[model samples]
Target: MGKASTVTSWLCCPCRCLFCGVLSCFLSVLACVLLTAGLVVLVLYLLFRPHIIHATAVSADLTNFTLTPRTWILRYNLSLALQLRNPNKRIAIHYHDVAAEAYYEGQRFAHADLPDFFQDTGESSPLNTAFLGHGSLVGGVAAAGFRREAAEGARFSIDVKLGAHMKLKLWVFRVPGPKPKIDCPLRLKRRNATAGAAGPPPEFRPTECRVWF
Candidate 1:
């Protein structure tokens, strides 16, 4: 019985050691794989740190504008010129579902839809959208403000907001990325009817606009 007990102990010890050895090998391989993945991510981030995508409102034209004093009805037609630029040397940007809105003193008066397009690395694309606001009623305060600006020869301000979904294309791999939100505050100089001269189109200074993800 003693000899049988000793033989059983020796057999169990070898089996336990073999099991432990296999588990250790698997754990080591998993750690190595995790480390490799982390390093790859770090490298990618470093390589793409300097490149940025930007959107700007380059110019705008207020073709027609009219206001009825009796009914406080406003009508206007405007066109906006937009530019999208990708400054990355190796990364391209794909933009989708672009939309824009124009607001006058927190009141939305116009909306525009832009086409989906892609911009290559170090390239820019131009976009033009026309906005029409026909027979829109305005509040008394808004009408008063417009009149005051016109009388004083002050610029009228309009806020334009843009939103779009974007993706990054690096060679054959297309990675999902963050969307962009852009705000362009435009100032329009009222046309001078007394001078019998048509004013120039509204100008947008890119440096004054804000762009973010």
Candidate 2:
């Protein structure tokens, strides 16, 4: 009876040890899983964070610019087309408006409240005229005196200010954060006017547009 009791005691200790080992292993696995899950949540939050910003500019050819038949009205008005491009892996969600300045013959004319829209998500968009040059005089001839014939062989300079809001998705791996205001300057020569020419300006070819993120 004593021998039997000793054997039973030895067997019970081994069984308890095995049970404790299993419990310990299970607890370790649970801890690891919990840590992994926390890391995943953190990664997802970072990947999905919003409010990214960006800016860029694309200028159209000045020579291909158009003027109305009423050359008198054109002296004060100059229209230019521009393209906005997003080089990031994200979509350009919004624009903060645009500002442009034109310089001709040493006179500086500023234009604000330019129109804006989204372009191809990964490509370029149709040329858009966001600014129109105007003179102080109300459609007065020579107020700005910028007829197409007079503009021939003339040189001009442009300064552009652009603002944009961009975003990234979880699928995109690498993306840049908010960007600084984009500034661009360009020089161009006016085109010669042609008789009997109709339709949009030669440089006014429309471009396909889209946006994806």
Candidate 3:
């Protein structure tokens, strides 16, 4: 009986040692995997920081503008150019459902839709939109304001508001977030009446605009 008890003790001790060794190896491997994953996430966050996109109204041309006093209707034809830029070095931007509007003294007159597009890292894209429509003036107050502006050098200042949904593209992952809004105000110069019968169109400069998400 003494010999049998000694043999059982020796067998159980080896079994316990083997079990402990396997558990230790598994825990070590798991810890290494977790550390590696954490490092990868940290690197990605540093490389792809959030950035604000910028837009500007680069140029505008007023071809034909007329206001009918009897009907209180304003008809205008304008060529507007825009510049969109992405400043992020490591992130691409995808824009969807972009809509733009042209306003004169808070009264909207025309609308345009921008094509959905993807902007690569550090890319600038030019967009051209046309505003050709007739809008009825609200009342005497608006008509009076318009006349005042027209008489003052015939200079017309128009405001454009842009709204779109944007997504960030990093490698194969797409991160979705809130929609982006932009407002660009443009100043159009009166045509050069002395140049010729059909004078040159109005010229505009790049107007800095801000983006909000």
How many collisions per candidate?
0, 5, 0
Query: Which regions of candidate 3 deviate over 4 angstroms?
Result: 1-45, 192-199
lDDT of 1 by residue, 1-213 (tens): 999999999989999999999999999999999999999989987887645567677777666556778887777777778787778888888989999888776778888889999988899888677888775546777887777766765467778888889888888899887878888888766454553336555454653457887
C-alpha TM-scores of all predictions: 0.71, 0.39, 0.73
* Every candidate's lDDT: 0.77, 0.47, 0.82
Candidate with best TM-score: 3
Score residue 57 of candidate 3 by CA lDDT: 81
- How does candidate 1 score on lDDT? 0.77
Candidate with best lDDT? 3
Q: What ordering of candidates by TM-score runs from best to worst?
A: 3, 1, 2
Candidate 3 positional error at 110, Å: 0.9
Candidate 3 weakest ten by summed lDDT: 192-201
RMSD in angstroms, all models? 7.2, 15.8, 10.8
Where is the poorest 10-residue window by lDDT in model 2? 204-213
Off by over 4 Å in 2: 1-76, 90-92, 103-108, 116-123, 130-133, 136-152, 164-180, 193-213
Q: List the residue pairs that clash in candidate 3.
A: none
